[model samples]
Target chain A: MTSSTTESEFGESRESDSDNPSVTKVARSKLSIALAAVFCLSVIMGTGPGVLLVNRPESISGIPLVYAWGILWYFVQVAVVIVASLTVWRSTGVAESCRTHNAPSRPERNSAERGEGELPR
Target chain B: MTIPILVVLIYLGVLLLFGWLGYRRGERSEEDYYLAGRGQGWFISAMTIMATFFSSFALLGAPGMVYREGLVFALVSLNVPIAGVAIYLLGNPIRRAGKRGGYITQADMLCDHYGDGVGLRLLVALVGFLFAIPYVMMQLKAGGELAAVLFSGYDHAFEAGAIVLSVITALYIMIGGMRSVAWTDALQCALLVMGMALGGISLVVSMGGPSAFLHEVNQLPTSSLTVPGNTGFWQLPMLFTVCLLMPIGGIIQPAQWMRFYSARDADTLRRSALIFSVLLTGCFIFAIMPIGLGGQVMYPLELSADGVAPNERVGSFDQILVVMLDDLMPRLLGEVAGATLSSLVIVAIMAAAMSTADSNLHALSALFTRDIYSRFLRRGCSEREKLWSGQLLIFVATAFSLVLVLIGSRPESSLSGLMQMIVTLALFAVAFSIQLLPMTLDVLFIGRGTRNAAIISLSCGLLVAFCFTPLFPLLFAKESSPLILWINAAKELIPMHASAWGLVVNGLVFVAVSVIESRVLKARSV
Candidate 1:
């Protein structure tokens, strides 16, 4: 099974230099974060207060003049996610990491890596 | 009685068919039995995630919530697509870390930060499965009740579900390992999408427009719509937080994380998440929400007729969506939609159940094979012994869960509420763990701390959630005389609403404890 282990199978393995984290990279990341924030905001804006804003006779659950409150709740939800994205992006602190212990032996790793997966370009 | 019994038998037969197919294909190698050799493609992987995520709750329960609540409740399900996006964003980190650390379970990621294997996996599994049991029962109970209503209340519907569901999942997981599970999941996802989309639109069109229904809803008093009722201040915030956090809860579930290993590559995992996030969430919400709202509009009088609340009815709030569709709609559409939704719902529910169950079953098998049985029970076991032992353990654990289901599950229980509770609490646990920033700090920065401290922090967070959020209220709040009413009222508050704020409390304790422990460890090293 250990017949193949091509280098290309690995995608930019986590070996980035961070000591002087590049400004351009940081700027690029922030842009991505802002884009995501905008996307989430758009969805929330599109759906959150739909009926609430219209002052329709039919309430969310028949309560008078209350759909606006539900819509407001969605606004807050959108704000929170947007904040988290911005905060996480600003810190450049690593996103949480995954770790496995009790290593399943070198031979096992070799066997598990038996077949290389080809990723599309 | 005979027909119900036959219906159960037929259902069980379907389960057995899947199970037998799996077990027959079982291989001797561990990888074959565990991860389907990780040869799964994007389609299967995506289905596995969607199917696992979709579950019976989405099929019957989420819509039920929407039925009982409103489209506002649809926000609770909005996290569906977010899960796929989250996976895409987080997949590289997860896969990379898994590669570096050789992590198997969801706990590994956190354990990576804590720099230890000590009980993190077990703590995760125990808490998750503990919450999961009620959910498992909800599915079985929903399946049973649905059958009972449709087939005239067969006494053995759940037992049949247990036979069908438990056996099929165990067999596939046991036989094809992750491969069969993923492939089956893809098909399950397809069925779910088709079933829910067609079933939902059909139900909605037949019911007439939602706008017509809302007209009646607006006439109710302000307070009823405000806090303490449907869309109160505390409700949406807590619900939104809960729903938003639901995607991250996947961070802890071993079933979803196992996909980390199952993906063809990190890219495949990302793509699957993005694709599924767009597709499944919409189909699932659309499928169930409209039907639920349709019921909310058309069937309220019947639901609220008795002195009891609408959610506490005999069949179940979750089953109400199906009931409304089956009973009120045109007969042929009802039957076809019923069967389609049921099959879709069944597969989705099964996929959700097994996505966790198979993962749980396999992880437990691995934990036993790698962590416990092989480590302590019998040292120097052979390869075949490990393989067979893993299979045997999966069988035993699954059987045990079924037994637990039979014992723990009550036909009279609230399926919709129980389903929500499990997913809700799982988020609480995960969110709570994020609180132990000290543990995170310790591992990433090599801050001095022992595995014991990290382990305790996990335990502490879990303990706080169980003690304050749920058990305390159940034990004390309802026991007192005047206090009982207040306690019931208090259950609606933010912290009490699914113990939404418990995550905050959990974080504080973990970080404080970890920081203190880190200082102590530093002094010792010095």
Candidate 2:
């Protein structure tokens, strides 16, 4: 059941790139990796120890250095989210696929049956 | 007085009307009521998510922290965007799982993943209850605080305000369910954004605009402009841990977990992630941050031997924003306009409080009904029966939180000792919710945790987190006990937030137990 669900969710993406599945797969994988890297970097610089480097009394453009540091990282994080949303999250046929493949056949009748097991990987 | 009262009444009436509309539009199914048929759009999803993520904490507590702590909280505000990022990274998968499996509560999805056991379900539900009640109490307390300021001349204004807010919020969720809650959240989100912008602008203008405001802020004591802040609370380790964990903790709490379930699709959450990060961060940075700095410049805290305290004009740290609006709006904009603007901003603050209260109450109802009542109390209950039970739970939970808030509000009451800044309550609540994080990540991504592991780990996490809360000594430990002394020393040495501490223990326990359980199962099979 889990394998079937996974197949259905990713099946459309495969079909959309059937002409060159390997290239598209590699590209998507690379983009996801890059996005994750950027996100991690932003978190480190924005809120982690990177903040200590800039935590000072001095002002940047009249804003406190730490605050200005936060704002810069905020934009970086926002950019990462936007790029990921438009690229990796933008599946070819997710809405239709999710509806057909993901929707329960009927309302779950019992607690044991409801949310029956782990999600498709 | 008339203007503020009138404004509150009108705002509340609209919220009730939305609740009624949601009732009229809703189907009688449990999913329809609890998850809004899992069809919330990007706009409503984003707004409701934002509105729920922020609470009076955003308006009152955050600025209060900034006012008291200085620029330190401005850095703390960065947590909002991290939460935004989580919406897509964490939320999308959760949504996909929820849609596929027809899950309504956090416990449902989690129990499903860990292979449902009564103990695991109960523990998960307990976590939800613990998170919801304190959070609900905080929102109710905000209402009381607002009323005390807005209706200062009236006797028992605080009590009246809290009761009204609680009753109204409960009624709406009881009537409209998720639809009404989400719609009202949308309107409240708009009001909150407007209020933040307007409040910031008024403060800046009153200080003679941007340059003058910056100059005044710059002139504040060096402590107010640097790390550890005015009170020395936000040390580097504390700030780093809080910024790292609080948002993750906030995003996985019961109310937000259901929001992920309610989202229409992956795209809805994807869009919500972007909007949430961009719009909320903008509001916090531009609008909310200034209010705190301006508060320091306008109404400076008293520096005493004990520590810095709020100015005489300000009743408490949380009251700083309300006091600023009351004093500045009237003085800056003339009598009629200032009062009107003040009323609107007050309503916005109330909106922030109500939006959160309604979501938690609604989510609590679902948690009780789906996770506990139907499963344990009455198996195979009708959909209508479950729905009715959920609604009743909302009313009962609201009353319970109201009573707790009222008790805490009393000066002589022991519970009053527990009540501090709104942010403190928020962090306390988040500590409990953060216990779910290790399990949630495993269920969503890692898929290695056992049911026994989840239960044991969550219990340990909750215990450790509770020890860090202010209520620990009040309830269990004597003030002078070796245990209390050691805990305090540990806290002072580490300086991490309660949520981080809990997550650290929770994550470690979860991994260790899972590994051990897996090994045991493998040996038995062999």
Candidate 3:
């Protein structure tokens, strides 16, 4: 029963400056904001008031209109994620920020002391 | 019954073996116990997330709802993808914050961001615990109901099944911690997907073929084929509210929150999101929908104006999938193969239940130890002590859930279907969990509001949510509660889901209080 009081175990460094917010970072943030806003509106439109328009007895591809509309958005959401991940999210360097070995593995802990939860090497 | 029981027993044995392996691999630290040292690969992470998200509700409650309501609940099924979108949008930010802040539990992250002084830690922990309990209880109920069906005519079979499933899930989670939970969840996810696809296919083929199956469904009442659906329970407004709010509740809950923290990397989560949004969830909606619709044709319901009126003839809607598989699979596949396939499907359903149960119990133990006992009762307790405390809480929580299941299972129990009650309880859990949404958004994205606003908003939100729930009336004797009458009047006028009502109140209060408090602080400084 021991408490790991060392700051290293927590993966926090008061001195580290990984997230140096820059103009590019701000632009990326704005893009993320725009994407989030669009996503929310899509959800509301597709699932909310949109249900009224498509709530019909008509069939397309043998599927009812409402069910068809619902399924359409399922694909749309996936496409949204793909577009965001590939375009806006990739260039932000957040993926690189994610590679830091924050958790203490048995061998890794004993082997070295490096910055954790941050870019490696 | 014998074959299915044997198959399930074998499945349980394999889970136990995984648990033992998890124990061997586990280290003596909270990181290893709770987050699996954050080293899960993309595939494993994807499967675990999918499995934990689905649970018995997807297999049982969902199909039952579809069978009862028709196309309306199918739209409800679309919420899974909405949750997938939430994972991609909300999950990455939370993961980034979790890594940066070194937070494990939901409370850990929230308390870290908002400052723990104004009771943010305890409030988040309480909401999480409230959500986890009913979620765990429902999974336990699914186990018992599955057993009662498989072992019909056996006395105390339901109780035995519930207890056994609880013990096995708890043992594995306690032994290996998150590592075992994740690994077993992967196994469970595979079994779940295979079972759903195979089961759906078997269902379709038994009735003839795809065309024949579609013909049968099309011949049903037009209400079943349209929106507002057969039951009319999913009216446009209610449907809108449920579709919008429910997925938020589903993703932001405690277990899913921790999964975001435990991911190996952003790439892993992105792939996981792909599987979640497209592959797994897509398969689920496609596969399970046909089986449920087929159930309607097999056992036709008498439709009144609103929808399929509740008829005692059909018995429990929850048992539709189970009953259909039992009767149809044998006739379609041939005797031995049908029995074996049906047995595997039954085990898959059980796997769904166990996967969710283990996750919630594991999360509860973490929340109790880290957020409550360690934080308030004794700060700086050793990691080993906290782990042991968590293990102990798992047993206590399981026992409490078992008592509730037994009471619900009784002959003269006031509650209806065990599955239905479980579903209600899970929604109640979500009602409270959704209260955390504003706080979550504030922490993850907006970065506004003080601790006082969080505490007050959550408190008022839970109050409004409780009042809107059926429990509020029942607690006060439904006929005797004047407040119930008043609320009923209001509900009739508005026609909104309880969770939606709660969210509105919660959002308004959070914004108002935050604005007022911030202005007060500004004026004082001036």
Which candidate number would show the highest DockQ if scored against the true structure? 2
lDDT of 3 by residue, B1-526 (tens): 5777688879988998998998898897897888888777788888888888888887777777778877666677766767777776777777766665567888877765555553777878888887888788888888887776666678877888889889999888888899889999999999989888987888888888987887777776777777776756677777777777777887898998888889876666777776787776576567788877888888887776554543453446666777887788788887788889999988888889999999999999989998888877888889889999999999999888878777877766654332354456667677888888898887766766767888899888888987887666655556557877889997787766778888889889998999999999999999
- Model 2 misplaced regions, further than 4 Å: A1-19, A92-121
Is model 3 an incorrect, acceptable, medium or high docking prediction? incorrect
Q: What is the TM-score of each candidate against the true structure?
A: 0.74, 0.93, 0.88
- In model 3, the runs with Cα more than 4 Å from the true position are A1-42, A92-121, B304-314, B411-422
Clash numbers, per candidate = 13, 0, 2
Give the total clashing residue pairs for model 1: 13
Model 2: which docking level applies?
acceptable
lDDT of 1 by residue, A3-120 (tens): 2222223233343324444664686568677767765764454333332354333443443343444334334544444454344432322222212234442223333454423210
Per-residue accuracy of model 2 over B351-395 as CA lDDT, tens digit each:
999999999999999999989899889999899999999999999
lDDT of 1 by residue, B1-526 (tens): 3433444455445544555565566565665566665556667777777776666656665665555555555555556655655665555445555555555555544544443354764665465455444444444444554554554456776567666667766776676555556656665566666657765776656645555545544543333333333434234455555555556555435566667656666546655765665566556545665666566555662323242235333265556755664554435455544455444444444444445555556666665665555645788888789878878977887777667556545545332222333333344334443333444344434445556666676566555555444434444445556755554465555334333344555555656776787798789999
Kept native contacts, as fractions per model, are: 0.09, 0.33, 0.26
DockQ of predictions, in order shown? 0.11, 0.28, 0.16
Superior by TM-score: candidate 2 or candidate 3: 2
* Ten contiguous residues minimizing lDDT sum, candidate 1 chain B: B414-423
- DockQ, candidate 3, vs. native dimer: 0.16
Question: What ordering of candidates by TM-score runs from best to worst?
Answer: 2, 3, 1
